[model samples]
Target: MESGERTLITLFEEIVNRFPHRVAITAGDQELRYRELDRRANAVARRLRESGTTDEAPVALFLPRGAELAVGLLGVLKAGAAYVPLDPDHPGDRITWTLKDTGASHVVTVPGYADLFAGSGVLPVLVGMDAEAEAPSLRGGPPGAEDLAYVIHTSGSTGLPKGVEIEHRHVVRLFDVTHPWFGFDEHDVWALFHSIAFDFSVWEFWGALLFGGRLVIMPKPVARSPRALHELLRVQGVTVLNQTASAFARLAAADDGAERPLTALRVVVFGGERLDVGRLRGWIARHGDAHPRLVNMYGITEATVHASHRPITAADLDAPGVSPIGFPLPDLVFHVLDEDGRPVAEGVAGELYLSGAGVARGYLGRTELTKERFVELADPTGGACRAYRTGDRVLALPDGDHVYLGRTDDQVKIRGYRVEPGEVEAVLLRAPEVSAAVVLAHSYGEDDVRLIAHVVSDEDPSVLAPRLGQLAAGLLPEHMRPSAYLVRTGLPLTPNGKVDKARMPAPTAETISAPVAEPDGTSAELTDTERRIALIWQAVLEVPRVGRDTDFFDLGGTSLSLLRMFQQVNSEFGTGLDITVLIEAASVAELAQRVEAARAVSPSAP
Candidate 1:
């Protein structure tokens, strides 16, 4: 298929015509063949056209991750409208903000979420309501190659999120340029493991459907549990897998005792965060570099999804510390420029600027921001071309690879999610008690990072901590929420009166209150299982002592730490428990009850 010849919908139509009877998507027990998917999407497009959707206005997809999501995406494109992805897991206010900001005409969602847009003034089209409707006669028309395909909202330095308007040609160019090098075919089974709101989903979803490959819609719980993910990879015969560096580390660590773990996986693409090549040593030792080639792609939302790719090998792991982000894609050009916007010499660290077909149009409704970040550069060939200024500090190696230094701004990536500290700080300041606020990311482990909030308030630390946490929970997503909340009388300041982040003290266990004594004034005795769990929590959380009633998260345990805790429990007890169990039982005492119940039902119970 030619890159500029058609939009994604037309390209997908061509594939559907060729492979109608083939299974296109699978989620749990539901499977949709290519023909059926096309017909269903056409029906949805008919309904959307009736609702007055157009190429200029985008439709909001507020559905869960399932076959319906795939249908919604294709259906919106078939209707000649860009689709705005909305994650149901985001806070209600965030969703409402996005819905209003985008000014979408309609939202495609199940009945359960219809109430979320109740007062938002947008129409909701339930998935099953018009299942028997006729397919749209105008399918795959109106939208041109340069038309907007989707508007993905990303974190902003300002309090609100900014929508990135990406065109069909950019997406087409992405697959067009990378497909030949990656060699993705119909035989490959791709996993849609990321939230649709995240840019990574763009590559995962389209890379499969556009290539005539079977796409597996991973359930949310399965995506979170490494063991479950490992089993799914084997059972579903997933050939091409994509994961963030942190998530891949968990998956690799979960394969401790398996002889041939992830052997079915042929290609594993790592993106959304820095690829710490050292973390892959265990997986490489077990499976070797021959199968499931590891490719690290450094990218940003503004630049479509990916900009460069580097195939990591065991030899690359032996390097001291630096992991180089490989060369840019054929259609894209990257330049390392100094503060003056002049290109820097090779090996000099500077801000990276990207110019290419994959570069997005600009931030929606943010004209000044778009102008500042996306600027026109004088091309050596004579005409001026636009480039996106990536606030990343990178040094271009002599061999053409780029070594990632760090960020030039306050943006920090937590678990592969881009977080602007100012955004979190803005949310923190919304609380009435907060006089001043600062949010920062701190290293929880070698490969794990967590956010922490430092606030200045007259209120007592014990009194204000929980309120701030509650506010954050109601406002921010899980990744953006601060793992630890520290209250200070006043924030440390530099000589220039700016908040001195370097002088901020790290949060300690002392911030957490000790577990209360038992009802009868005596300490609660721990059972054998409880004792084991306590020990594991202590080791994972780095706490000196853990009481039976101690909350894991309250003791500074995060999602990564919870995974390690579960791994330890599974190893010690020989019991397979899902990570959600920890979420359900936030305290050791409650978790002990769950463990006892599972043990009683176990076939090997003594």
Candidate 2:
């Protein structure tokens, strides 16, 4: 609680005063200590104040995931304005979208991306050694308890993204609660795995600064690569390994090449998804001598990073699936309630609501949505305490903990049966041949939600598709099986490194020929040539199905995918459909006729 007086500004003051000369951040061969970061941040902060940017204004940060981003973020906070992080690796459209939405007055970016925002009217402040050392123009007022610290925008599955406004008090509370749990000390060296845009990076940033520990920011390539991450762990002397479940799974799945003994790993914190305990045990079993502590954290962006966590051991893995997220932080309260707003019995799945100081103020400029998701506790302890309905389905376990069920909205009804798409996708990903999978409700007049598998292996979808369906049948319910299987060299990924479902291809009627031949098959019969062309449509648009009259772009097909499709047709069928044909003849029937006409041309018809 003493840290309450020490806001973002105070935290930096403490570091500059106490550990000025201590090494603060290290990226590549470059090293910066506390005193340098403090001085640079002050200069940037002062420059910001002179520009009339105050506490309420948001400054956009488009620096890479390294020291520049760290400095810029701290500087923006020092200027008493919230910082909006846009990953430099993201597409220009994504960055432009966030910038325009946030209404950021100034953008701090490298010289490379300067031209990307040319017409945005945002003042570009280039980050370099000079900007870092410039003296702060004037000291800004300190941030208040409820003052906005930062705004993190989450990709909305349904529509445009919404920014979650986090306050200083929320950050303070998270640090206070998690500090005691981790028992971090000045000697700790934690690996920073997440991008600056995500809220979890706050944990890696403040967690280190608050405890005077070392923060080793992994290079983007190293962070994404399992082998590189494993190597960094051994080389960097990372005592605390924090990553998402996806990252953990990859690390745990890696083969035993030259075992990089993770002897220094005191704690491994995993979150962002349901971790497979089987893989956890298997990973530990192979590296038994390492004896690292495994901690599972459960939290939301609405809450300042993490609110609950539990440590796991080899013995705990033997009991069942992944363990329940333990009780809330000491200063927080987590309740499990049923639909009628009554407390549920242990082992009964209910909506998990969180009440704590760590809950964020609300969504930025979205009071309606904020009030909808975060409501007053049905069982109130009086006074202004409000509980955030996490929209997460969880249960009170017999062991006095909470088990995380998938999201309530996450489950979709397919053919009148409820199916968790994530559950099916998890099974699909488990197949060594499959690199990624996504299941969505594909409407074909029957409201049949089809499962789509995007495999990276060289195996043919015709042979592998049936085998995968068989595998799913054995492991999942009949309704959970993917109606159609599609294989690709790679799955489309958004700039944020998540599966870009919107970019997935459309399913053409012809590609479903195999199942259609079986009579009970949902697909209609189409010939071999038609089937081959239909596959091109599915691979390009990422849609569930293409009707005879369905348009291509209307189904989320893009010009880039169309170009690739034209090339595929040329290589495989000795016919290249005019790129303009996609626009002129949007429907499959029209496109098929056009393709037939194209085939009539000779190779010499340039």
Off by over 4 Å in 1: 129-134, 137-140, 511-539, 542-594, 597-606
- Per-prediction RMSD in angstroms? 4.6, 14.6
Q: What is the TM-score of each candidate against the true structure?
A: 0.90, 0.69
Pairs in clash, predicted candidate 2: 46-137, 504-541, 504-542, 505-541, 505-542, 505-543, 506-538, 506-541, 506-542, 506-543
Best by lDDT: 1
Candidate 2 lDDT tens digits, 58-129: 899988767777778888888888899887655455577788888898987778877877878898776665
* Residue 102 lDDT, candidate 1, scale 0-100: 88
Cα lDDT tens digits, model 1, 36-129, are 8888888778778877887657799999888889988888888888899999888888888888888887998888888877777899876652
- lDDT (CA) per prediction: 0.81, 0.68
Worst window of 10 by summed lDDT in candidate 1 = 512-521
Query: Candidate 2: which stretches are off by over 4 Å?
Result: 1-3, 131-137, 287-290, 380-384, 411-606
Q: Candidate 1 overall Cα lDDT vs. reference?
A: 0.81
Deviation from native of the Cα of residue 155 in model 2, angstroms: 2.4
**Residue 554's C-alpha lDDT in candidate 2?**
36
